[model samples]
Target: METRKGLKPALVAAAVAAAFAAPVEARITKIEITSRGPAFGGVEFPGVGAYERLVGVASGEVNPASSNNSMIVDVNLAPKNARGNVEYKFDFYILKPVDLSKGNHRVMYEPPNRGGKTFGPFNRTTGGNDPSSTTNPLGQFLAPRGYTMVFSGWDKAAGTNTANFNATITLPIAKNADGTSITGPSYEYIVMGNATTTSYNLNYPAASLTDKSAAKLTRRARIDDAATVIPATGWDFVDANSIKLLPDGTTFAANDIYEFSYVAKDPTVNGLGLAAVRDWNSFLRFNVTDDSGTANPLAGDVQKIYTYVLSQPGRLLNDFRYYGFNQDESGRKVFDGMLQWIAAADGLNLNLRFSQPQRTQRNRQDQLYAEGIFPFAHQSTTDPLTGKTAGRYDKCLASNTCPLALEVYSANEYWVKAASLFHTNPAGTQDLADPPYARYYLMSSHQHGTGNGTARGSCQQLGNPLNANPTLRALFIALDQWATNGTAPPPSAIPRLADGTLAAAMPQSGMGFPNIPGVQYTGLKSTRFLLNYGPQFDSGIMTINPPATVAPFFDNPANGKIYPTFVPKTDSDGNDVAGIKVPDVMVPLATYTGWSLRAAANGGPDGCEGSGQMIPFAKTRADREAAADPRLSVAERYGTFGQYMYARGNSIVQLMNQRLLLDEDAYAEYTAGLAAVRAGSLLKDE
Candidate 1:
C-alpha cells in the first residue's frame, strides 16, 4: 500500500506526563462502505467539503486491554485470539476533501453517549433520533477542515437495532475448563411505573435453572432504602434464555425499584465493550491489514485520531484508560487526544460477569456498584480511610500511551456526585494540582437536564436552567488545537479549599444565604466514599449474592475509605464562587445553585438526585419589599439594558483575560447575551 498521507511523528503524551514513545504507525485489512449521504440535512461543513455519512460493519480479533484473561468467557473459545474474532457494525459520518491538498487528513472518533435514548448519538444537540440541521452539538465545525468524523457505540446491553442506536460488538460466551457453565449472582434496579411490569432484563443471563426458586428477587423504594425480599415473586421464562417478572401476589408499587439475584448463566464478556471502541478506532487509524480481517475505512486519508465522549461515553473513556486500553495490542496508541465531559466519578462498569454499562448511580435512587472505586485522579492517591494507594493512570503510564486529555464537569458533580474526591484528599484539603496530561474544568452554575424554574416549587428550590455547553464548545476547539498542533490550552479552573472556593457542604444554613420564603432548602448533598462491595465485586465476580454492601451503605452520614464529601463554597447570594465564572456569575441575573430539590412528582423530595437550581433576583426594590426578599434586587444590581450589558461585557472581557473563556466564545457570547439583555430576557423586569 503506497502512503498518500504523510507519516506524522507519533506525539508522546509524556511531555504532559513523562517518557518518550515510538513514532505512529497504522494498518487495516479493508473497508466495506455500505451507504453514503449528506448529514445534518446538507449543512455544508466549514473546512471540509460536503459530508458523506457511511454505514458498514467491521470485524477483527482483539486482545484484552491487559493480561486480564477473564473478559474471554469460554476457556475453550477460540485459539486464534482467546477473546475471539468478532464483527461489529457501525454507522459513521465523514467528509472527503474536494481539494485533498488543502484538507487536514485527521479523524475524530466521537464515541456514542448511550445513557438511554436521550443521551445516545444522532448528531443532535438535545440528543435523539432527530439530526439537527439548524443546531448540531457534535462539534460539526471540524467537518470543513477535512476531518473524518466517526461514532461507534460501546454498550452491548443496548438494543441491536443499529439504525436507531449505536453499534454493538459480538462477544463470545465464557465457560469453565471442565465445560460446565459458570454462573454468578447479579442484580437489577428497575425504575417503577405502576409495578405491574414484573419482568426486567438481567445484566447477564441468570444461570439456567430447572427450578425458579433458586433465584431470589427483592424490592426497595430506593437503592439505599431498606428492602422487602419478595418470597412470592414469580417468574415466567421468556425462553430458556430469558425470564420475566410474574406479577402474582407481589404488589409491585409504582416508580420503585425491584431487584433480583439469580443463578445467571451466560455471563456476557461486557468488559470487551470498551475494547471494541479502542480496537475499532485503532484499526481505522493505523493498519493496512493483518490476518484479523479489519479493513481500514479511511487509511491513508486519515493521519491523526482524536475521540470525544460526553457524559456516559466519557465514563467509558475513563474505563478505557483505566485498563491501559489506550495502548493497543500492537503497541500503538489509539486516541491521540480525548475530551471527557460530565463523567463525574463514573468509570464504566464493563468488565463484570453480568455487566450492564448503563447502570448510572443517581443519588438516593439507583446508586450502586464498585465502578466508583479507588484511583480516580490521574495521579496516585492514598486513601486515608483505607491506607491503600491507587491511581487511574498506572496502566497508561506503564505503556507510555497516555493521551492528551481534558475533563469538563458541571456543578452537579460536586453537589450530587462524588466528583469532589477527584481533587481532594479523603479527610483533608479540597484542592490538588491536576495531572500533567489532563485538565479539569468545573462549569459553575450549570445543569445538564431541562428545568422549570417555577413550575416545580415543590422541589427544594427552582431548577437551574443554565448549561455549560457554550464553554464546552469553546474548549472543544482548544483541545483540537492543542492535540493536532501542540497549542497549549487555558489553565484549568476548579474550586480550591486553599482559596476558600471549595469547602465542606451543609444541608441548609451557614453559607450566608438569604431566607427565601416558600423555597425549602434541599438540605441534602450526595455522599461520596470509598466502599467495600465484598471481595469479588471489582473483579466482576460477585460473591455476596443479591447485593453485597458494607454496613454504612444506607447511612446518609457515612464516609468512604479516605474522605467525607466536599462541595464548592458559596457566596452570600447562595451561589458557588469557584470554577469557570461565565457571564451569569460575573454579571448578576439569578443566584444559581449546583443543587435542586426534586419535586414530589420527580424525585420524591428526599435528595432530588443531581439537579441544579436557579433563584432569580427580584426585579426591583419595590418587588423585594413586597416579597420581603432579603437579597439584592436585579434593579439594585443593574438598571436598564445599558447597565446589564456593561457588566456582561466587562465579565466576558475579564474571563477572556483570565483565559477562562476563549476569545471566539467571548465574542459570540457578547453578541448573543447583549441581544438577550436588550430583548429583556436575561435581565428581566419580573
Candidate 2:
C-alpha cells in the first residue's frame, strides 16, 4: 500500500513500515479488556487457528501534535478478535475500528442500529446471532478466507447497550476562543406525537425548556413548504422536556414539523463522530503514535480495510465520505473499500447543530433534510436542480483516500427513499449511469428491513416477512473478492436510461401497483425537502433562528427541474425487474413489495413509514378465483406442491449461476425454504 500525498511525514511503526508508509498522530493507547473469551464458541476461526474475543474499550487521545489537544476520543470496542494471529485486517462497523495494520488484508461489517446494535461473536441472551453462520450467512464462508471482526462506538447519544454489545462515546464540548459556551438554533419534527398529548418532549434540551414564555412553535403540514408560525398563545412549554398545544392535542397533526427556536447550550462538535473514526482507523492501520499514549498493536500486518454499513449507518458512511473524513488528520486513509446498504443517495442527518442522526427521511410526514441533497452519485455531477456539482468522493480521490465502493439498496428507496433521483434527473426524462469506481444494486422486493415491523394491526396488509439479509451475504462475498483481488463484482442491476425499465415521478396510480383486497395504498411518498439550516450549519453550528423552509421550483414535479423520483420497472407480480432476484420473489411465494401503505387508522396511507408488505397468494386455484388474486396461485403456476418445490429449486440454480447466490449457501437456503414450504402446506396436489 502506498501513502497518499498530504500525510507524507506520518510516523509508521517498524512493523508497519516494513510493508508501507502510513500517517502518524493516533494509535490505540489502552486496550481495556472488559472480557475475553474464545471466539466462535471456542472453535478456531477457520483459517485463523484459535481466535479469542477481546471485549473492551480502546482509549486514547488524538495526536495533540497532529491535531488540537482538545479532542480526546474514547472508543468502546466490543469484541476484538485474536489468535496466534496469522495476519488480520480490522473488519469494522457503521463507524469504528481498533487496529488496522495487524492481520489479513480484508474485513467486513454490519452497523445494525443507531450505531449501538453491533453485536457479533457473542452468544446473546437471545440466541446465536452470528451473521456469518445464520443471520447474514456471509461470515460462515468469509471466516475460512481470513478476515478479522471489529466493532466499536462513534455516536455519543446511542442508547443503553444490551448484553455484551454495549457501546457509547465521550465527546468534548465545543467552545469559542473566548472560552464562552456555544449556543444555537435547533429544530425537531416529531414523527407522530399524540396531538392532544400533554407533556410532549423535545429531542434535546432547549433554552426555553424552563421558560414557557420564550418557547416559540410553528407548524408545517408538509416538509416542502413554508410553515405558519403559531402565535405564542398557540403552545406552551410545560417543563424542560415537555410541551402542550393550545385549543387541543389535535392541533398537533401527524407528519407536522414543529419548529422551535432555542439557544442550546454545551454544543458537542458531534460532527466529530467522523473525525474520531478517521483518527482511530489511521491509528490502527498506520500504528502512528496516538493521543491514547500507547502502542499500536496490529501495525505492520494490516493490508486493507473494508466497511459494510446497514441502513442508518449506511447513511453515516455517505456523510463520512461526503465530508472527506476518509482522509485522516495525519493524511492517512481510513477505509480501502466500503459497502453502503440501502442509503438511497442520502447522508446522515448528523454533523449539523443538534444533529438527529438517528432520524431519517421520515416517509411522507417529516423533514427530509440531509437524506436528499448534493453529491447524489459516486462521481459528482452538476445538480440539475441547483447547478452546483461535486462528487461525494472528490476530496478523497484528490487525496488518494478514496476507497472502492459498493452500494446496495432496496426497492423502497425508489418508491420513497429518494433512490430514483440517483438514476433519473430532477426533470425525470432519463436515467443516470453509475461510475466505474462503484457498483449499485437494488435488492428488489424488499423494504428497509424486515425487523421493526408489527402484525400490520395498523394497516390492512400483512406485514412484510421477507429478509434480504441472505442477498446481502452473497454480495458481501462478491465485494470482498472485488476489493481484495481486483475481481470486479457482478455488474450492478439497476434500471438504465437506455432501457424502458426506468420509471419516474409517477403518481400513485401511474406505477400500476395493484389494489389487493383490504390492502391500503397511499399516494404519499417520502418528502425530499430542500432545507437550508442557516449559513453556519456547515461549520457545525447552526446560526439561523427558526430555520426557514421553502420548496424550490426545481423540486416541484409540476415545475419539473428534471430531477425525478424514479423506480425500476416491475413484472406482472409487481416486483422490481432489476437486481439479484431472490427465490421468494422469483418462485412467487407471495407478493413482496418495497412499498406498503400505512393503514388510515394508523395515521398512514403515507408509505408505511418504512416497511414493505407481503400478500400471500391463494393456496388453490379455487381460492385464487375467490380472492380474485390478479396473479395465479403458486399451485396454479407450478401445478403442484412438488412442482412448486422443483421450480424454486431451479430458480436457486439460476441465481447461483448468475453469481447472485453462491453454490454453498444456495443449496442450504433452498433446502430450508423447501422444508418450510412443506410444513406450511401452502399448495397441495389435487
Candidate 3:
C-alpha cells in the first residue's frame, strides 16, 4: 500500500510489521466504520499536522474454553456462534494524525468512564464529550506530541452510542445449559428524591415485578445505620425497571439512602467486555485486517500502547489485570503501560454474574457492593482476614505480560476508597514494597475531583482547591518514557507506617491537625469489611446480594482493628506532610484536607463523599491571633507575594529534579499560584 498524502514514511513500520504478520489467532471477526472525517476541523497541531477521526463498531468472539477466558462467570452458559464461541460487539472512536507515518506510532486507549469520554483530565480541558474538537480541547500535551488517542465501549450499562454518550458494548446474554433465562439476586442503590421527584430507574429488569415477597426495599439514614424495611404496600414498581412511592404526591426525602433488592434475570456475558478491550487492542497492534477484510485503521502505525483510566474505569483496569485479560488470545501483551487516577485499592465487580461494574465503594454510599475485596496490592501479600495468597498482577506476572503500571491517588481516595491497602498489608499493620515494575504516588491534600483555587463552601467546610493536574501531566509523561524506553520514573511517594507521616485517623494529635475555627475533625473514614459472598465467590459467581460482612470493629490482638485504615499526617498548616506536594500544598494559601463532613441539612457528621476541605490562612498575624488559628499567617510565612512565588518556584524546581513536574507545566503552575495569592490579597504591608 502506498503511503497516504503528506505522510513521511519511517522505518518503525518495518520493525513492527513482522509482529503483525506473525499473529496466528483472530477473535475480531468484523470491523464496520460508521463515520470518518478530519478531527478538530483539520486544525493543525504544530509538529503533528491535521488529525483524522473514525467512529466504528468492532465485533468479536471469545473461546470460553480457553484458559484465558475460563475464569469468567457463566461463559459456558452464554449463547455461542456456529463455532461455539461467545460473540460481542463494542463501539470505538479513534483520533490520529491524518498522516500516520509521520506520527509517533504509539496508541493511548482511554476506556470510557460510564460511557462518557474522560480525556479531559489528560487534555486539561472540560465541557463537551465529543473529543474531536476544541469544545473539549485536546490541549497541546497529548496530540501535539504525536500520540494516536483511542476510545472504546466496554460497559453495556453505559447506554447507546451518541455524540454525548458514545463508547458502549453489546454482549450476549447468559442462559442455563437448557437455554432458560438465568435469574439471581440483584441490588439497586438509590439516593432518594426531593418533593417533585417521583421515581428512579433500576439497573436491571426485575424477574417478577409484582411478586412483593421476592423484592425488598429498605431505607437508612446513614451507611452504618440499621436498615428499616419499607412494607411492600408502601411502594410499588412502576415497571420491571423503575419504582416510586405508594401514595400520590408522596415523596422520598432528598439525600437519604434507599436499597432495593429483587430477583433479576438475563445476565449479559459481561466479562466479555474485558475480552473486547483485549482483542481490540490486539487487532490494532498485531493485525492488518479483520475477517471481513476491513483494514486496521492504524495497521502498521502502532508500536507501543498505553491505557489511561480514571475513577470507576480505573478499578476496571485493576480487575482487567486480576482476571488475566492482559494476555490476548494469541498470548501477546495488550497494554505496555497503564496510568490510573483516583482508583485507590478498590476492585471492580465486573467479572461476576449480574456484575455491576459501575458501583464503587464510598464513605457514605455504595459500601455493601463487592467492590472492596482481597488482593488489594499489585504484589502478592497474604490477606490476614481471608488467608488468601494472591496479588492483582499474579496471573499477568506468571504469564510474563505484566505491563509497567502507575497508580496515582488523591487525598480523597484515602478517606473514601481504602487507598492505604495498596501499600500496606491487608491488615494495614505494615507497609509492603511495590515490585520493580510498579510505582504509586499520592497527590497531597487533593480531592477526587479538581477544584479551582478558592475557599467556597460546598459540603460543610470550604471545598479543597488543591488540583493535581500539573503533577499528573508530569507523571503521564514519565509513565510513557518508562514504557517507551527503559527510563525509570520517579520513586513512589506515599505515607509510610514506618515513618510518622502515616498516622491513625482518630484524635487530632495523631493527624497533627491544628484547631482551625469552624472546621471539625472527626477522623471519619470509609472502613472495609470481609464480606461473605457464598462459596462460589472464588469462581466469580456472587450468590449473595448485599453480602453479609464481619463486624466493622474488631478486638483482634495483632492489629486491634479490622482492615485498619490510616490517613496522611498533616503539617501545622494542615497540608499533607508526605506524597508529591503540589505547589498549593508546598507553598500554602489555605489548610487543605482530604476529608470533608456533610452539612447538617444533608446528613450530619458523616463524610461528604469524595470531597476535601480548603480553609484559607489568615492574611496577617493579627487575623490569625483574632481567629485563634495555631498556624502562622500567610504574611508571617512569606512576608511578600514575591517571596511566596520564589518559594513555590524552588519547590517546582525540586519536583522537576525528581521528574514529578514537567518543564512545560511549571509556567502554568507559577501563573496560577501568583493569581491565587493576589486573589487572597496576601501582598506585603497591604
Candidate 4:
C-alpha cells in the first residue's frame, strides 16, 4: 500500500481498481434513525407530521470474502436530468482488521467521497440540512448529502406502515489538490418516513418517501413537588394504661426535645466465623470521616443547624433530614420552599448535634460482651418480710433483660429510642419514664445499619431486605396529624406476643414496665448487666465450649424478693458451713421468674463450661462448628431482639414525657403546631 502520514495513496487507488475489477457482494445488517417532532406522553411521537429537514448520511461497505481478502472500485449514481442522463462520480475502498495475522478480522470505512456533486463525504461537514431554509430544506439537505432515506412498509409485527428506516451508503475518498487522497471519517444517517432508498425505483420518487423534521420543542414538568412537614397537633393516648408518667406531672407532648447517644463497636476478633470488624469500621468511617473525600458537611452539623432552627419559638423543624444512628451515613435534602413554608407557619428555633461515643480500650469484659457470652451470677437482697434465708441460686442471664453492647441493642436502646422520643413523639403527658407521644415504626426487613437494606421506602432502607410496603406514606400522614391537631397517631400494628398479649393504654397511675416481662427494671446496673448476659452472651451458649445449661428464674410471690446461696464444694477436706458441703457466705438471688437461663455447670464434652466457656476461643471444636453453621452464631440469630427492646423503651419514654414534663394545654398546642407543619399547613398564631 502507498503510504501518506503512514497511509498509502497508491495502495488505495489499486484497491479501488481491484474492487471494481471483480463484482463484490454485500448485505444490509442493522439500521437506526431519529426524527424531530413533539414528544408524546409514553410513546416516542405524537401525531403524524413533518417539518423542515436537517442533515443526514447513509453508509455501509462491502464485506470481505474471506479473512484475508481486500478489494475496491469506482462508484457512480445516474439521474435523469432535464438535459438528459447525468452521472455523479464516486470512489470505494476495502479495509481489513489491524491484526490479520493474529486472526482478528473486521472492516471499517475510511474518508468517504470528497467532491463529486457532494461537497464532502459525510453530512456533518457537507452543509446539507439547514433548518433555516424555508423551501425544499429536506431535499437540499438529503440530496446533496447523498442520503438514501427510506420509510417503513406494512409489516405484520408493526401495525403502522410509516416507520422510518436507517440508511447507510459506501463510497471512496477523492484525491486532494496534490493528487494525494483526503482521508475522512465514515458516515451514516436515518430517514424517517419521507426520504428515498436505493431499492426504490427512480421513476417512483414518491414511493421512496422517508420522514424528516426541522425542529421540535420538548419540555418536562415536575409533578410531585411537595414537602414533608412535622405535625403540629400532639398525639393523644386514649388507652391510659399504655404509658407511664413522671413525678413532676409534665407529659410527653408535641415539640418536646430529647437526646440520644450510641456506640457502634467493632465486632469481636474471632479467628473463626464471620467477624464484624469490617462493617463496624465502615460505619465509623461513614459517620466520623468523609470517606467519599468530597468533604461534604457532616450529618452532625446539619442536625445542629436543624436544632437551632427548631429552638426558635413557633418554628417547625421539617426542613432537615437526619441519620448516623448505628453509625450509618444516610439522609436527604428537603425542598427549600418547604423549609420556608415551615418557618413561616411556626417561626423557627431548634438545635441538633451528632453524638459520638468516646472510644475506649477493650477490656476482658468487653470481649466477652461482644461475643454474647458472660458469667452467670444471682445477687440476692434480704427481704424484710421473709425471716428465713430463702434464696434461689440460678443463672438469670438468659432472660431478655441481659445487657450486651451488641449492634442490635445499640440500635434499639439508642437510635430507635432517641429518634422516637425527640424526633417523632408528642409532648405534654404525665409519663416521664416511657413517653407515649411517639409511634415506634420498624421496617419489617431492615438490616443492622440504616440503608443497608432495600431502598424501597424511606432513606433508612438503603441496604438489604427491602420492604415494598406503603407504610412510609402512612407514617407521613400520621406525623402530619400529630403535629397539627394534638391528636397522637396510634401505635403501629405489629404481631402479637407469643402469649397473645396486648399492652394497656397510656397514662395509667402506676409504674409501667417493658412488656419484656421480667426484663423491665429501673436500676441501671441490673438493666445493663441482665441485657448484656441475656442477649449478648447466653444467646451464643450452644456454640460455647462444653455446652452450657439454660435455666429460668421467676419472682417469689410469697417473700416479694430474691435471695441467693453459695454452691456446694465437692472437696472432702473443704470446711462444711451451713450443714451441707457448701460455703457459709450467702450469694444474692432473685425469685424464680418465668425467664430461662442456659449454663454449663460442668465442663461438657465440647470443651470448657460456665465461666471458662465465655473466653475468646477460636481453637475449640465448638467455635469451629459454630463458625461453619450460621444458626449457631449469636449475631446471626436474635440480632434484632435488642432493637425491638429499644423501640419499646422509646415508646414508653415518649408516653411518660407527655404526661409529666410539660403543661397539658401547652403540650397540646405544641403538638398541634407540629401536626399542621407536617400536614403542609403550619399554624401562624402562637
Q: Using lDDT, give the best candidate's number.
A: 3
Q: Model 4: per-residue lDDT, tens digit, 61-95?
A: 22322111111111111112342321121111111
Whole-model lDDT, model 1: 0.62
Give the alpha-carbon lDDT of every model.
Answer: 0.62, 0.59, 0.80, 0.18
TM-score each candidate: 0.85, 0.81, 0.94, 0.16
Model 1 lDDT tens row, 553-653 = 44433333335667777776777777887787767577887776656564465666656778777777898889988788877878666777778899888
CA error at residue 644 for candidate 3, angstroms: 1.4
The top-ranked prediction according to TM-score is 3
User: Poorest 10 consecutive residues of model 1 by lDDT?
Assistant: 11-20
Error of 3 at 625 (Å): 1.7
Write the number of the candidate with greater TM-score, choosing between 1 and 4. 1
lDDT of 3 by residue, 1-686 (tens): 12223333454455356345553433788999999998887788766788998998899988788887887788889888898888899899898998886677778898898888876756776634677766533465678878898999999888674756388999889888888888888888877535467787887778887687877787777666766778888899899888887785567768777887789989888888888889899888877788767788888667778887778888989989888889987777899999888888988888888888877778887755887888889999998786789999999998999989889999888888879999998887899887988999988998887754444443787777777777777888888888877789999999999987887786887688888888888888887767666677777777665422112212233223357778888887888999998887888888888778988777667778877888888889999999999989999999888889899999889988998888888888888888888777887633
TM-score of 3: 0.94
lDDT of 2: 0.59
- Which lDDT value does model 3 have at 605? 75
Runs of candidate 2 with Cα error greater than 4 angstroms are 1-31, 60-105, 109-112, 118-145, 161-164, 192-201, 209-214, 218-261, 288-295, 365-368, 425-427, 451-454, 505-509, 537-562
Candidate 2 vs. true structure, TM-score: 0.81
What are the root-mean-square deviations of the candidates from the true structure over C-alphas? 5.4, 7.4, 3.4, 36.5
